[model samples]
Target: MRQQERLGLILDRLAKHGTVSVLDLTTELSASPASIRRDLKALEDQQLLKRTHGGAVAAEVIYELPMRYRTGRHQEEKNRIAQAAARLVTDSVHSVGLGGGTTTTELARALGSVGRSLKVVTNALNIAGDLSVRSAIDLVVTGGSVRPESYELVGPIADRALAGIHLDLVFLGVDGIDATGGISTHDEVEAQTDHCLMQTATRVVVLADSSKVGNRAFTRIAPIEEVAMLITDSAAGAPDLERLRAAGVEVITV
Candidate 1:
């Protein structure tokens, strides 16, 4: 196949499966890993894909932009971040708290495929739906008021549930993350719920795309130091990254 046609096929696979392992790509493409790596590198250079430790993912899935805006942006970045964050989980982690948002939803989806013995606590109805049918995983949907726009279960009920539970890790997604504001959300109730979620969890990981850096939304959830890690795409600029590091947050860039 022509190089252009081959690269197109790789991207199509990435779009279809959220993520692709290099070994799988090697088999499917019927090409040398070296050749596939070169193809991936070329596509990454064009911003059409983002390379992970094992494979390339479509780049349009990482944005915090509204659903319509996210429709065609950063797929590879989100997959990369989701995969990176997934590696942090082990079978020993019996319980996890998942925040509301597309990225967190992606994390939930990734986890569903990998771990069979996990108890997931989440306020996102869609996230609950994604894992509900998976008999291998235990799902806990926090009872709360629903925010239809974001599909999040927020407000007092959500906050109370978080207060009563403890988790190994809280996978948090945000509308904006800024040096000044720390972690933030656009809705006050969601912000309050997020704060409670963070407080109950042993560790907090702030999952966001590069575009979210330096942007402050309407409410602050927690300070930067409270976040154990910030998993973001490579598009996050050096200065923003420096700030995150200086604040003592481990920044993982994929």
Candidate 2:
């Protein structure tokens, strides 16, 4: 596997098991022990994990992986979800809001390719960068402090920027979504900013891969009822889908 792919897998395993042994990673990643050690060291330098004698452990306060590392995970599923979401941005939808995440980033690219005139508002540095160059997109980027891990801008400044603006639809990328805990993310500040974006839109659609479905993250963005629809991969469990639908969210498995 490529280094980026290896690094992503290592962190994913650490997140699930809380610790990973060099032997296990070497076997699972099909890489040399030295290569695995190097990967561990690289993550340690980023403070993403703590290097152990023969392995690594999760950081004291585990935050979401940076966007670059997360891009390769569930990539195919994200692309499918993005395409399905793009269909919702019909000509009648003049203005749209996009939240930060890998899946939403893909949606931005899909929108650009559709060659439709749109007033796009976003708080993601990466998404803004991508859409800014598209002539058909009148891009509006909110002002706020940047969160490196997710490439999202959050805090009071962003909230103020969203205050009076209105959107026909908004696509939010969340860290987790569940029937009870509702929609959530890893950072409380980002969750608050995301909530502010939702308030500006008449319709709210959440984009999440199956892994995020049925899970609850650190901060709640809003209750499930606040969402109009959820687009996820078919890998999501049937029971979870039923629960989400029962909570008044139209769940779509792409």
Cα lDDT of model 1 by residue, 1-254, tens digit: 56665676776677668777779988987988888989889878767779999896668743222342243346688888999989888867788899877788789899998747888898899899999988878888889998865788999988888777889999998878876569988788888988988987899999998978778887888888789899999999889888888888899999
Worst lDDT window (10 residues) for model 1? 63-72
Q: What is the Å distance of residue 122 in model 2 from its true position?
A: 0.2
Highest TM-score against the true fold, candidate? 2
TM-score of each predicted structure versus truth: 0.73, 0.94
> What value of lDDT does candidate 1 attain over all alpha carbons?
0.82
Cα deviation at 240, candidate 1, in Å, is 0.6
lDDT per residue as tens, model 2, 42-111: 9999999999999999999876788888978999999999999999999799999999999999999999
